[model samples]
Target: MQALLFEPNVQRIADETTGPITYQPGVIAPDLAASWFAALLQGVDWHESSRMMYERMVGVPRLHGHYAADDPSLPKVLGAALGIAKAQFRAPFNSIGLNFYRDEHDSVAPHNDKLHELVPHQPIVLLSLGATRTMVIRRKTPPHLKTELELEAGSLLLMGWNAQLNYDHGIPKLRYPVGPRISVAFRVRPGWSEDGW
Candidate 1:
């Protein structure tokens, strides 16, 4: 197998008080990205998501799916992809979450990953597939520093363990047309399975 490579111009979006947020473009081989994207789109059991906003429930603009560690039910392609990520990152990832952005309108609100669930100091690895989209990260406190990044297909983002402490990240809605995209986030949660939490 050929070794995976990242773009030379890796960007670090962080400051003195916050943990590192590194973006490595082209982490997946370009030749394989197309096929992998297609397989995941068809294989994962994706569904619309919603959450309580203010006093009312609102539908999230994207689709979502999840795979627990050692889940035998995952499709072969997704399982293989998970294996690759685990080997590449060398993290004890216990869960995987998939977010599908069907078009330019799908977006996620700025927020940090829930820290109570994740094991501290373990980086979260996010792999991007399909269309490129912009991700924004902003400081949670005064000064309110911010940065924007174009998350390209086949890219990988490593969010440091402490990155969540001071910053919030999200994918904002775009007005222009964009094809579908998928992001797979690998994490090491405290629980063994979804039910354990």
Candidate 2:
């Protein structure tokens, strides 16, 4: 793995085992990221969500929303971001998932994305906004080695499809207080229905 330090605060992470993962901070610039964050905070139809975990309904730590490729209701800010991702990554992304971490308490468990729903060979692109947070990616098999990176405002993390099959990633909760953060994940799910996954 080669860590290309672009600046004091920005770096790129890539490893052979993890496939083509790349982290580019300042991809959207500070001012633009902040503006997009504010717009998404207000424009998105955010909702408190829960999932059946171990046969019990438990609330997810963050607010969530999804936008289909052709959905007229897709927020302009997100649509623009998708455009950028499409041009840069050249992935056929058709869906956008948004997760709003209100503070340090909000988090996501370490798990791979639903592979069946994603287009094969396409990369999953994550655009980070607002506060910086640590994202941990761990090996799925025994030994469970892990890598941690601070995802800062306007950063981009591209997770290759092969990486999803071999590792799990998440944002762990922090004990100390931190500002809000929002992540926009762009994925390609061909033949997606109105009833999404």
Candidate 3:
């Protein structure tokens, strides 16, 4: 496996490995990752807007994507990182969903990607950049449990099968100040959205 950084250490989150979902921390070389991110931020058109959810699900506000046009270098590096991540965790991934969260108030509520748009048993690789924020992952049950973690810039978080199947993840709005945040979410979704536009 090609290491994103030699001697990179894993930061473990509080979760029962026996309980289906596992969140592992990975790191990429900042300089390299930043270059790709810069290219992406420059190459793609980004908009500040919100998306409404169907059937009263939580809505997503202040987000944008960098996937509407040709991005040769960004996707390659991201795909390579996903490859390493898959081998490291024994998970499979292919496509990437990139989002820019502009500030403290910009947020995404608890929700999972539509199942029909994903491949069963594959994982999602989320890479965070620019600034840090707390990502809350909660299970769907009484007592209403939750786990919150500060995802630092240049950090990678992987959500596997059980997570996608059983839990919901999101970045809640914080009243305090926070800088811009960019998240690159990579996944495997064969023949899902080929219009690529």
Q: What digit string (tens of lDDT, one per residue) describes model 1 on residues 126-186?
A: 9899999999989888999888999998888888789999889999999899999999999
Worst lDDT run of 10 residues, candidate 3, spans 13-22
Q: Write down the TM-score for model 1.
A: 0.91
TM-score of each model, in listed order:
0.91, 0.88, 0.75
All candidates' lDDT scores? 0.85, 0.85, 0.66
How does candidate 1 score on lDDT?
A: 0.85
Give the clashing residue pairs of candidate 3, or none: 95-187
Off by over 4 Å in 3: 1-3, 11-20, 24-26, 48-50, 53-60, 66-83, 86-92, 192-197
Ranking by lDDT: 2, 1, 3
Whole-structure CA lDDT of model 2 = 0.85
lDDT of 2 by residue, 40-100 (tens): 9999999997899999999999999989966888888887898888977888788999999
- Residue 91 displacement in candidate 2 (angstroms): 0.9
Better of 2 and 3 by lDDT: 2
Which lDDT tens digits does candidate 3 get at residues 1-197? 32475655555442444134444444666676667667666654566554455756554576676442223444555556566666666654546667888789888878866777777767666778777889997776665578898887566786765566567888999999988877887777756444542
Q: In model 2, what lDDT does residue 18 have?
A: 63
